[model samples]
Target: MRLLILGTGGMANAHAKNFSAIDGVEVVGGVDVDPSRVEAFNAMHNIPHGFGSLDAALNWGEFDAIANVTPDSVHHPTTMAALAAGKHVFCEKPLATDYARAIEMTEAAEAAGVVAMVNLTYRNVAQLQKARELVQAGELGKVKHFEASYLQSWLVSKAWGDWRTESQWLWRLSKKHGSNGTLGDIGIHILDFAVYGAGSDIDKVFCRLETFNKAEGDRIGEYDLDANDSFAMTAQLENGALGVVHATRWATGHFNELRLRVYGERGSVEVQHRHDWSKLFTCLGDDAETGKWTETEVPSVPTNYERFFEAVQMGRTLEPSFRHATSLQRVLDLSMLTDRDRREHEVYL
Candidate 1:
């Protein structure tokens, strides 16, 4: 299996390195609008061919897969073009800046009959993998409640000066460019991994959105700060489990933390991020009340790139497929509507 990376951003290196490490997979080329960035990326990663534009990569046509790690706004166009060119796609999360475009992208991939996977990075967390396995194996019985949060302090521009001065984060706060803001960036991942761990889909959402302290005039450049800094929602799953979901870049003490806990009839499981990694805990049996939580050692698992290559080789749909992404987008779309009316919205998939 051969691949073409779609961007020269920070994540493109990880993609190139991880795929290149696989025995049968090769990263044949890379595409980026900036020729100098492309040059640097190739120099750093040894990607044999680099293209100034995606069209160039499409014309070269030597790869069977696309690692679509481009910006939020351009995901739809890049993934669609690659899919149309008869390549499988591994897209970065928040499938598109807009929900409608996300739907269209998934539909196109399905119609093209290619395996598709969204890089919901949280799903790759070792502890979360254990949580997912526990949920599926009934070690956690029928889940009754779920709670998750992803918090970060990057937007605490005081420590790093104004992030609005940086090119990397400027567009991320734009309503048109960033779309749902922190919700799309970090919130979607919480919802994704929560749904994955719970072994069900969310059916409704009642949400609160905040753009509070991060104001439009507070930025350095002529930037758009229309996106939210935080979002919290109460969600109901298809399995009758209730949950709370939260994501923010404003939590003062948290550098970056994502935590998830699920309670079921027979057991309960929890996972927490620590220093960019994770820890898993499980409480089972009648000892649940009296016994201390036992830390479950998470086993090793394949990287998203490895899974993508495996799916391509096996001719099967990948886990956390484009279909799942559309459902997650449904939750986000309805959450926006819920915020508007201050009412619960059905997540109609």
Candidate 2:
């Protein structure tokens, strides 16, 4: 498979590495709005073609698929363009800035009859996949409660600024670019994982969001910190499950910790996805007297990019489907309103 990468960001680099790792895949070219970024990626990967504009690369028409790693704001247009051009597309998370746009992108892909996938990388984790299987197979019967939290300390420090401080990373802060803040970034991942792992679809969501840390005095970023840094939500699922999702960039000791727990009639499962170590723990059955909890070990495995590529190649539905992705975006879009509603001591769902 020949691929064209649409952005030269860190996530784009990760995607390139994964595709390059596959034997039959070739990264034919890359395009970035920044000429320097395009040149750097070209030099780093020894890519055959590099263009400073996506339009130019699209006109080249040398790739079978387009990796739309552009910011969330442009995801819709970029993916639509790829689909209209009859190329398969793989986009980064939060499919589009909003649910409507995501729906439009999905419609375009469907109309064009091309494969489209969102890079919700966690869906590819083997342990998480196993958890989903167990839940689906009734190993964890009738999931009743679910919760997920993704914590990162990067925004807790003063040195956390990167592309987020520039217009280059549009939508990283502004709701217009997408839904404002952490909800769009890491929160969507947690929500997607929770809903997917529990084998359910969220029917309703009530959330509260906060922007405790802004780009104020002595801060480390250039753009206005107009987005939330933390959020919490309660959701009702289609499978009669109740769930909560919490995400924050302020946890001091937590650096990229994505944790999930689900409780059901038969058993409960917990997942810890972190660097240095990752594990899955299980508690089977309930005890009143001895209060015993059975612990089943979950083995650590390799990263998820490989599975994403295979799914796309095989033309199968990957976890965190566009339908699920759109639901997550809706929750994020609603969270912005929750922030304002709570300030007035009002609850909004």
Candidate 3:
């Protein structure tokens, strides 16, 4: 498969690495707005065709797929153009900044009869899949509660300096980029994973999103700031399972800590990140307290990015299908759309 990667950001770099290693796939070209970025991508990956604008890649005739790894602000435009031009598209997550555009993008893909995939990479985690399988096989019985969190300290202190200083968190904070802050970033990931692992859809959500700190002066550039750094939500799934999802960029100690736990009638399972220790532990029901936890040791499966190309080659379903991606976006929209006064409204079963 010949692919055109449309960004030279960090995520794009990761995608390039994976695509380069895939047996039948070739990253034919790349496009980035910055000349330095495009040049760097071509230099590092040895890609033959490098263009300074997405328009060049869109007009290029040799590419079979377009990877829209650009920033959140331009995802819709790039993906739509790629789909309209008869190229299959694989977009980074939070497909578009908002729900309506996300719907439009998917509809256009369907209308054009092109394959579209969203990069919800966490779903491809092998241990998470094992958790899903265990739930479905009744090993965990009736799921009662689900909790997942993505905690990162990357934005904990603006004084220490970070990539965010380049732009006053506008890409994540502005309405033009879709929803504000964590709801669109880390929150959406956990929401999708929760629904995927639980095999259910969220019927309703009650969220409390906040921005505790603001850019003090003019150092963080100039942008209309109306986004949150943290969000906590309680969701009621269609399957009678309750869930809590919390995502924050302000956590002090955790650096990209992602953890998930599910409690069910027969047992419970938990997963913790960055630990060489047994990643999954299940507590099956028993009368006595004699070490009821089942220690399921999971060997890390190979990363899922390359598998995406393999699936594309075989015409198989992508891990988080495009429809699933849309559903995840819907949950995000509903949560973030709640009025400020009702951000913490309760949903009773």
Candidate 4:
């Protein structure tokens, strides 16, 4: 499949590289607002075409699919446009900053009958897959509780946005941009992976959000620092399980760590995926050493890029689709709105 990657962010480059490495995929053109970055990205990837905007690319680019790699703000519009044009799309997560807009995007894609998937990349993690299998196979029988977190130290200092030449590390801190900072960014991944692996849906959320690392003085720039840097929530699952989910960008020692443990009546499983290493532990109900944990091998899952191409080329439905993001979007939207005024919020379906 030939593709046009919108937005010249680092993720755009990653998409280009991943697609290029696929068996029969090509990055035909790229679109970015910055002309210099457009030229640079194309030169770096050796793509045959470049455009100044998505409108221009949609008008003239030769591609059957689009990779919406833009910021969270533009996800709704760009993806809607791509679906309207009858093109398949691989959009970034959160679907949109607004729940209504996310619904519209998913509906548009569904109406178009196009393969649309949100870039919930962690869905491809092998350990998470293994955990999901354990839950599905009843190894962890009747899950009763769960604890999940995605932590990173990038926002502790000011180097979070040093990689990309955009927003001065404050877009996430902006209401007009990110809406829900750490929650929307990485916390959504925790919600997604935990529920996904546990094969359950969250039914309620009681949240606590913090802005401990808010920008001060000259650091605010043009963006507002009202967005949260850390968030902790107690979630009640549809399966009557109480779970804790936490995300913080100021986690001092952690680079990027996603850990989840699901406790069931008979057995339990703990899965950890870190930037450096990953591990999964399980305990069967009949283990003689009652509280013992044994390391289990993680299942090897396929990459999203490979799955996306396969879905597009084979006319199959995209798992972790925009629909899934819309589901997660509601959680983020409510998380953004939940505060001292409204302490506990019920997760809608």
Candidate 5:
């Protein structure tokens, strides 16, 4: 597979490295609005071609697939262009800024009959995969409740760098810069984590979003820190499970963490991915009687990058597909309305 990385941002490095490492895949080129950045990305990845824009790269048309590491708002147009050009696409999360655009992209990918997938990075966690497996196999015996959270201290700590001065960090805090704040950023992630781990879809959601003041003026040069910093959601799953999903950049002490706990009539499962490490625990059978949780060893699973390559090769769409992402985006869209109306909203995919 000849792959073109669609953006030269920080995430593009991971895309280039991972795809280049695949035996049958090659990172042939990179695209960025900044010529210098694209050139530097090509050099760093030992890529042969660099284009200043997606249009330029599409006109050249040498690559078989595209790794879309573009910003949340740019995913729609670029991905539509790639699909129109008959190229498979692996896009970053949130699919698009809103459900209308996301559904359009999803329909386009379907109509184009191409392999289109989203990079909901948490899907790579072995513990999350195992937890879902247990729930599906009835080991959890009908999930009744679940709680999931995506936490980061980037706003409070310099562990990830200063958000006040960095464009990369600031862009995520500004709505005009194509950001939906923590709700649109990490909220989609934990929402996916909760629903996927519970092995069900979200049926309804009630969300509350908050944006804490970071700077005195709440303005950082061209970027306005008006985007939400935190969001808490109450969701009802299709399997009759009630779940709480939330995310925040104000979570002090934690650099980056994703945790989910699913409770069922017969058993309970817990999965945690902190920093880069993941662990799984379960209370089942006799252990459930005593409420004793025992840690379990989970086998590793393929990353989203690997799965995308395989899906393209096999001519099949995979989970985290454009359609699935659009479904999640539907929930996210309704979440905003729920917050606005101060009431729960039913999710319709």
Candidate 6:
């Protein structure tokens, strides 16, 4: 598979490295609005071609697929263009800035009959994958409740770098810069984590989002740090399980972590991915009687990058398809409404 990496930002490096490592895939080119950045990225990855814009790359049109590492707002336009050009796409999360645009992209991808998928990165977590399998197999009989969270201390720590002066971090804090704040950013991951691990779709959601002041007068040059810093959500699963889902950049101690606990009548499961390692624990059979949780062996799974290559080769989309992402975006869209109206909202998809 010949792959063109879009955006050439920080995440784009991961895309280029992972795809280039795949035996059948080649990171042929890269596209970015900044010529120097794209040129540097191409040199770093040993790629042969670099284009200043998506249009230029599409006109060159040598790649079979594109790894869309663009900002949240740019996903729609770049992805649509790729689909129109009959190229398969592996897009970054959120799919689009809003549900309507996500639906349009999903529908267009389906109509184009190409392999289109979203990078819900956590799907690569072995523990998450195993927990979902156990739940589906009735090991966790009839999930009744779940608690999930995605936490980061980027706002309070320089572990990831100083967000105050960085464009990469500042863009995520401004709505005009195409950010959905904490809810739009990491919220999607936690929602997917809880919903997918519980092995059910979200039926409804009640959300409360908070935007904490990070700067004096709440203005950072051209950026307004008004995007949400924290959010808490109550969600109902289609299978009748109730779950609490939340995420925040203000989580002081943690750098980056995703944790989930699923409770059922016959058994329970817990999964955590922190600092790149993952572990799964379960309470089942007689152990459930004593509430004793034991660690379960979780096998490694293929990463989303590998899966996208496989999908392209097989000519069929996989689990984290644009359609599935659009479904998740519906919950996210409704989450904003619920926060604004201060009421619960039913999720349609």
Q: What lDDT score belongs to each candidate, Candidate 1 first?
A: 0.85, 0.75, 0.76, 0.83, 0.92, 0.93
lDDT of 5 by residue, 1-349 (tens): 9999999999999899889888999889999999899989999999999998899999999989999999998999999999999999999998999999998999899999999999999999999999999999999787899999999999999988888788989999999999999989988888889889999999989999998888889999998989999999999999889989989998899999999999999999999999868999999878998989999998899999999999999998898899898899889889889989999998965
Between the candidate structures 4 and 5, which one is better when assessed by lDDT? Answer: 5
TM-score of each: 0.95, 0.88, 0.90, 0.94, 0.99, 0.99
For residues 98-117, could you state the per-residue lDDT of candidate 4 as single tens digits? 78999999899889999998
After TM-score superposition, the amount by which residue 173's alpha carbon in candidate 5 deviates from its true location, in angstroms, is 0.6
Where in model 1 is the C-alpha error above 4 Å? Answer: 157-162, 215-219
| Candidate 6 wrongly placed segments (more than 4 Å) | none
**Residue-pair clashes per candidate:** 0, 0, 0, 0, 0, 0
Q: Which stretches of candidate 2 lie over 4 Å from their true place?
A: 158-171, 174-179, 215-222, 285-304, 315-317, 338-349
Task: Identify the candidate with maximal lDDT.
Answer: 6
lDDT, candidate 6, at 105: 99
TM-score of 4: 0.94
Candidate 4: regions farther than 4 A off? 157-168, 213-219
Q: Give residue 135's error in model 4 in angstroms.
A: 0.4
lDDT of 3 by residue, 267-292 (tens): 78776664233266777768114647
Write model 2 residue lDDT over 1-349, tens digit each, in one string.
8889999988888888888898788999999999998999978987889998878988889888888888778888888888889987878898987778988887777777777777887875556767777889887788899988998876555444544454644346555445458887888788878887788777777788877755555234445556777888888788888878899888888767888888888887777888556667776655412445554566544444555566667876464456557767777776666666753212124
